[model samples]
Each structure stands twice: as C-alpha cells, then as structure tokens.
Target chain A: MTDLLRVVDPGLYTTVQDLGRPHAISSGVPPGGAMDRFAHSAANLLVGNDIGAATLECTLIGPRLVAEAPCLVAVTGADCELLINARPAPMWSGIFLSTGDELHFGARRSGARMHIAVSGGVAADRWLGSLSTNVIAGRGGMHGRPLMSGDVIAAVAERSGPGVSGRELDPHLRPDYSNHTLGVIAGPHMKRLDADGRAALLGSTFHVSRDADRMGYRLDGATLRAAGDELLSFGLVAGALQVPGGGQPILLMADHQTAGGYPVVAVVVSASMAIAAQLVPGDEVRFEETTIEAALRVRRERRAALDSLRS
Target chain B: MPPPRSTTRVRIHPLGDTALLAELGTRLDTALNTRAIALAAALKKRRDVRQAVAGYATVTVHFDPDQTTHEALGSAIKRLATKRPPMEEPGRLHRIPVVYDGPDLESVAGALGLQPQAVAEIHTRPIYRVFLVGFVPGWAYLGPLPEELAMPRRDVPRTLVPAGSVAIAGRQTGIYPLATPGGWHLIGRTSVKLFLPDSDPPSLFRAGDRVKFFGVRP
Candidate 1:
C-alpha cells in the first residue's frame, strides 16, 4: 500500500498548510501557513513525508479519515480526542492503518490547532511554493476554504519508495497547551513606556477574546494605555500585541498583515509560539516578562530538543 | 498603569525567526518613523544579524539559529541600540502631476480656511520626503504638509479611495497605491502607479525618496 486516507468527517475547521509564503508581504499579502510550524514539521517527519508537505491545520475539532491503503500517520500539537471506528486513538502518537479503517477526531481537550500528517502528504496544487490556505484572498489549499463534512482529498504521489514505517515523536517534544504563561522579549518601544505601564504589562492576566482567529488574537485585560498618542504606520509581525486607541492589546498571529500602526506592549518569544497557536477563544493568557537573554535561551533549548529527535 | 504620557512610546520587539514588531508610537508622525526605520536598518548591520525588520517604532532582528543562540543575538542587538541618523535625504525627486478635483476637495479647502487655489498652492509649495511605505502595498506616506494646510481626517473613510488619489491627514499627505478603504481627506488624483506588485521594486517610494507635486492639466 502506497497511499493513505480520505476525509470522512471534516470537523470544525481544517485547512492545508506548509511553511507559508514570505515574499508577498510588500504587496499587501500576508504570509499565512501553519500556525504551529514546529508541530507541523514534526508530524510530517514522523510519517516520512517531506517537511514542506501539505498537512492538515485542524482547529478545535479534527477530521475523520478512512484509509484507502496502508499508510502511516501522526498527530501533533494540542491534545484532542481521537477515535478509530468508535475506538479511542491516543493523541501525540503515530499509528498505522489498513484500507477500510476509520479515524475520527473529537472535540479538543486542550489547545486550538492540531497537525495531522500522512506518509505521502496531502495531494493539493501548489501556489507560490506552498499549499497553505489563505482564506482572505480566497486562494490555495482546498479551494481556499475550510474542510466540510464530506471532503475527499487524494494522497500525494510518493517521491521515495515506501520503505520506512512511521514513528512517534519523543514524548518530551509534545507541548503543554494547558499552560497559560508565555515568555516574551522586550521590543524597541520598551523604553517608551513608563515603569508602571511596563509593570502592568508583565503582571496582568489577559483573556483571549472570542474574536481570535488566524489573523490576530484580541485580549481582554487591564486597559494598556499607550505612552504616546497615535503612531506612524510601521511593519507588523506575528506575536505583536498592538494596543490601539481603545487600549486593548491585540496579538497579531500567523496570518497577520505585513504592517500596522498600533503600539505593541511586548512580543511573544519564538519558543512559546507553539503554545500561542493552541490558544482558543476565552483561553486565559498571562505574559511572563523575560529579558532578551531568557527568550533566546528558551529558543535554543527548544531547537536542541527538536534536533535530538531528528538525529 | 501610570498616568498616560502626552506622547506615547511604541514598544518594539524581536519576533523569533520571522520579523520584527514595532509598536506604534503616539501620534504617528514622519520624523519618529524615519528615525525608527533607519535605526532598524543600521542596528541590523551589526554582528550576526540576518534580517532587519522594522515597523512603526519597533525593530525585530532575525538571525540563523544554527549560527548563534537567540540570547547572543538579542544581547548583540541591545548593545547596538543608539540614536538614529537624521532622516536620510531622498536620492531623487519625483514630480507627480495631480488633478485637483476630488470629491472632497471643496470640504477640505473650507476646513483649512482657504480657497481651493490657496490650498493647492500650499500643497505644491514645498517638496516632501517619502517617510515609509505601508497600509497597503506601495502606499507612500509622504510628509510634513504646511501647518496651515494640515487638516483632520474625515470622520467617515471612503469605502474605496481610487488608486492614485492624493489625500492628506494631520501633518502628512500620501498617494494611495491601490483602490482601498481610506479615511484621509482627498484633495486631488494622480495617474502615477505608486505600487506595482509585479515590478522589481514593488514600491514607487522607499524610506528615503523625495516627492513634489504639480497641478496637472486635464
């Protein structure tokens, strides 16, 4: 058996994603792809699929799969309930399936987005060197929309002969989505804010508002007053918590626009981004301020962990 | 939170592996933004940096993880922080001809307490520098309009301000690169394509470009 499964149950929101498009920002196009890049990559590697393969960006609920041939698959990122023909399938583990077997993912137990990678990847047309879906522009990834109840996606053609079986990622590599604390690095405007503004930013507890999406996550918390009035328009990136006129902080995410004019309080660090991706609306988030040194150290440790798995 | 400062200081932070996020400073102006962009570019040139990403008042530096740790990269950046150079003078001048006949022209002139011709004269009197490109692709946020000509933005933004529309907000003027929703007061229109996505230099104006306007004949 060379290929994999077809979608029998397309849950809440599932879209295909790869690394994302980078060069399109200057044209008012956002670089959108997988929210959890590390998790996506790990899942792909587990199934022996190429790192850039089109994987499923499953939201609160994941899709159901029916195998058409024997194939290996793995799930990474947030903990979600999984079942095989009504029997439970464990999260964060690799499994094999034969033709006619069924796999279904239930409501999320923790986290927002999950990654499901099959051995040969999802067969979809590539645009701008990625299969990531961009719903705003209505392009790429399964006709630029979320998966529905009855979608049948064909498996991609295999490049390497089917000689390897899927393996599970090291248990330690799994992210703890239940944790609300995230690390951040001080930004250029840190000097602009006064001591109290800075203190309040780090000490406060912010709830992820229901308005959160791939574009950005709006927070409901102690109003964060800007040090100055309006600001000049500048570039924006993911993890930026921009406070506009209302003083509410909005954290930009993977599908964020290339530029913005809101004053940011702090930026989420790289290592904690996977955790950020798992945040759902109403999830509580508290920022644990760290020096640039701490943020970087965290990143290095995470990378080292990932490297060890690959080796 | 402390008593709000009269002038807001926008926060800037490094977003790992991707880009920088510059929290917008208070009263988005041309001068501070110019300093921010140039400083970001300069700060990026120092040791072990990969890319210099600037926005508003914050700049993020992206580097290769294999070459260095994020800690080393951040400390290296903090050491390099310093005052930015004066806004770099524009390399070249672009004289764009604009037809002073937008729908909002009359209201804008009245708000500035000047006749339509006087407003036009004030607009064309001084050459402006292109501070930065943002809001939409190729949109040029041009600057330092004569204080007398400076006007508040329209309470209701146009749903679709045509491409090439010359508009003004408090202390600044700009050319819309494409047809998009805008809140600036429109005074005229131009035919120059400020942004061409397919072109080599997608943006017509860089951070350090100069611009002058002329009254075009229909």
Candidate 2:
C-alpha cells in the first residue's frame, strides 16, 4: 500500500468510484461508477488529476478523513460545508493537506452526492478494470463495501506533475441542482406505451421517491401503462426510464442492472444524467425530450466545457 | 468481404449520448443472443466504445461521447452487425456440488408427481448453458431446465433468499451467489463462491459457459 487514510466517520454512504467498468456489463456486472460524473470530473480536475482517477462518492453526507501523507484534495458536486482542523476550507477548489490533517464535511446544501478527489486518486481494489464500488455484488472499491468507521483506504500518491493547490473551478462549471429538468431520448420501447401513456411519461412531473438509489430512482408521480404482456429480459443502459406494471416510472441510474424486462418509455440523455443523479428524495423532476442528434451535441459541448476548465 | 447483412437485420437505437442499444431481434431466440454477443465482442474492441452489455436479444453499447458520436457509434455497430460473425468458442464446463434438501423440493416433487430423488437426479444431470447473467452478480441464468423441472416463478416472491441458494423458474435454473429478494423456487444449495469483486474476473460464469451439478452428501 502506498499510503492509507483512516476513516473517522464514513458518513451516510461513501464509496470509491471512477469512470466505471462499462464493458463488464457483458459479464452481468452493473456499471457501478460515479453517479455524478460531471462533479467527479470537476473534482479530479481541481486536483490536477485525470478523469480516470478514482474519487470517493459521498452520498448525501460526506466522510471525515485523517491524512496520513501530504497530498492535494478537492470536493465537488453537492455544496457541502468543508472544514479542516476545525477551520473552514473551500470546496470545488484544490487544497493541499499536510500529514495528520483532519477533513470533515457537513450539511448538504445542494445535490445528493459529493465527489472528493484526492491527488493520485484512490488505488482501492479494482474489479473488472474499475475502482467503483458495487454494493449489490459485494465487490470493488474499499473491501467491496461501504466505508465503515475505522476502515483504512489506500491512495497511490505518486504523480507525474507537481501537485497544484489553492485553485477553484469557474462557478459556471460547478453543478447547480436548481435545474430540475432532465433531457431524454425518445425511446427504444416507447411503442410499448399508447399515446396518452406516452403523454403521461413526458407531460407529468415526478417527485423523487425515497426508493431512489444508485440502482434506480423510483418516481412518485405519472403513470404510464405499458401495453402487452411481460417483455423478455433485454439489455438496459443507464438513464433508461422504465415503467413497470405498477405504471410508476423508475429511472435507471449508474449502478443499474445490466438487463431488465420492464418497458422503457424514454432514456435520459447522457448530457443530463448528472443533473438527474444530483436529485435528492422529495425533489421534483420534469423531462424534456430531445433527439439523439441534439443529445450528442449537448454532450460534446459539456465535455468541451470540462476540458476547457483544465487548461 | 461482402457488406455485413443478415436476413433479419439488427436495429440500432440510441440509449443516450453515451450508449447505443442494438436490437438483434424481438423474440427470445438463441441465435439472436449469439449475434448480440458477437456484436458486443466486436464493439468492445473499438477505442470509442466503452462497454457492451449482452442481453437475451439486445446488446447495449456504452461509448465515450467525448471520443465518438452517436451517429458514428451507430454506424460502427451497423457495420459490425451486417458482417457474418465468427462461430462461438466452446465454453468451459463447471461442476457444482449441491445438497438436494430444499424447502420446495417436496412441493416441487408433488407438483410434478415425482419422487424427490427423481427430481434431484434430473436437476443434477444436464449440462445447462449459462445464459446472460443478470438480476445479481455471479447469479447465472441456466436454461431450458429439461421442461419437466421447469416451473413458473412464485406468485409471491421471498423478501430475502440466502446466498448460494439453488433455484429455478420457468424454462430457467440458477443459484443465488448472494442473498437478495427473489421469486424463483428454491430447490437446493451450493457451496461455491460465484463472485469475488476484488478478483480479476469477478464473475465465475460468462454468457456461454456450461454448468452441471452433482449431488453431495450433507
């Protein structure tokens, strides 16, 4: 082990996440990567780390860690209070930590998940080429489980370039959970729904149910009756809005099952998936339909925006 | 080589900006699944493609939007699907030892009007093909359970089925590697660990692997 950070309070739910092992879906593995890739990338960029660097995805509440070595750290996504040694520390910015420094997070003011990117990233156990923790499968990340108090996480601190600190991302690039609308691609199985049923899917608003998690988000409103008997289990991508027999919609998230049998009404475009991920329970969400062409364009623009921040 | 085209063309659809779903066919045919797996294998080699998910009749490809466009990925998949796929390589055979004592064994025996030992004999004989693993990791969906052993999923699903519990549903048989809620009828138990997330290949079975169970003294 290069170095290890002792967990003081793992908080609500903290796990290691990188870009995720997308190809492992063939082996029935869910793509259990960072739910909010936008924030995750931003946090990594703040620390001068690349997109592939493993960052800790703090769910709702964040973890308290004691630094065992000198390194750079940055927190992004949910606008949470960051404190070091009982003093206020900046968020969405890189901060250099000395040995024995204690970092604490408090009160999520925005978004549901936060990303804490450390210099050189977490070298936690990698499974199928990803450091993301898949709790359902009990594999990957730190010991294949949620970070518990007293658990030690390994971080590889060697870097190619000199570590930079005291830098912040432009405010415009920071994620704001205020935008409740998610863009979606029409459907792979939208024909499963009748006209009014499709209308209910896009027309009605959905309140995030408590059932929402990395697997999927269960929405509280809008019923879209699916036509026909049960479908054969088919491949599902992240961001699919599947409406089961109950008529209520369940939006698949990052850690969604590789396959599902439900009828899909629409797919949330990748450009807006991070926006969808940041939604907390009880939050209202609306869907805006976009063409695949437009969705691709939006994604390119977003990626370009993130790339520009690194320069 | 002639342009890739099949009598039944595969439909390429969008999952989003980052992924594309290739619908090989509408029905549940083994040939369709083979094509999906082949297409996935071809797609996975592309630098622009991130991941390819093989389902019963569909292959969902998660790509890097930054490196590739939706149109570009769709075209690549179309080209790949149009070509004749190479024959599938034979899968490795796995022997799983099982204890036939189960809560539903007697009920299943009664339902089939057969002895519990006969049921175990049938369950233990066949070399089941590993269909695409899903529902949970390392939980292989073994198929076509001899028709005689096949039964519909329970009307009421159990809230928590224990790990390594062997089970069956209509036209399918499997073992739960990890405890979770399930609707399949449990018939036995296995001692093998099917998944280790920390390992290089986390899952023990892939799509086409062969599996056979043997009765073990309990």
Best by lDDT: 2
| Candidate 2 chain A, run of 10 with poorest lDDT | A153-162
lDDT of 1 by residue, B1-218 (tens): 99664224444346534344444354555555566667666756655555454544445455565566555655554444443355566557899999988788899888767898788878988889776665566776677788998877888778898888999998889988777789998889999988754454567777657899999776
On a 0 to 1 TM-score scale, where does candidate 1 land against the true structure?
0.77
Residue B62 lDDT, candidate 2, scale 0-100: 78
Off by over 4 Å in 1: A1-10, A23-28, A64-70, A97-103, A123-130, A139-166, B1-50, B54-59, B69-106, B115-130, B135-138, B144-148, B154-166, B175-182, B186-218
Q: What Cα-based lDDT does every candidate model obtain?
A: 0.72, 0.82
DockQ values for all predictions? Answer: 0.27, 0.58
Name the candidate that leads on DockQ.
2
lDDT of 1 at A124: 65
Question: What is the C-alpha lDDT profile of model 1 across A1-311, one tens digit per residue?
Answer: 24467777787789999878655454445668899877887777766676788889998888888888777777888887777777887655567877888988766677888898877788765655568887754567887787776676666866333434445566666656678898876654555567777787788889999989998888998877777656666666678777776778888888886676666667887778888998988889988877666766767776665555454
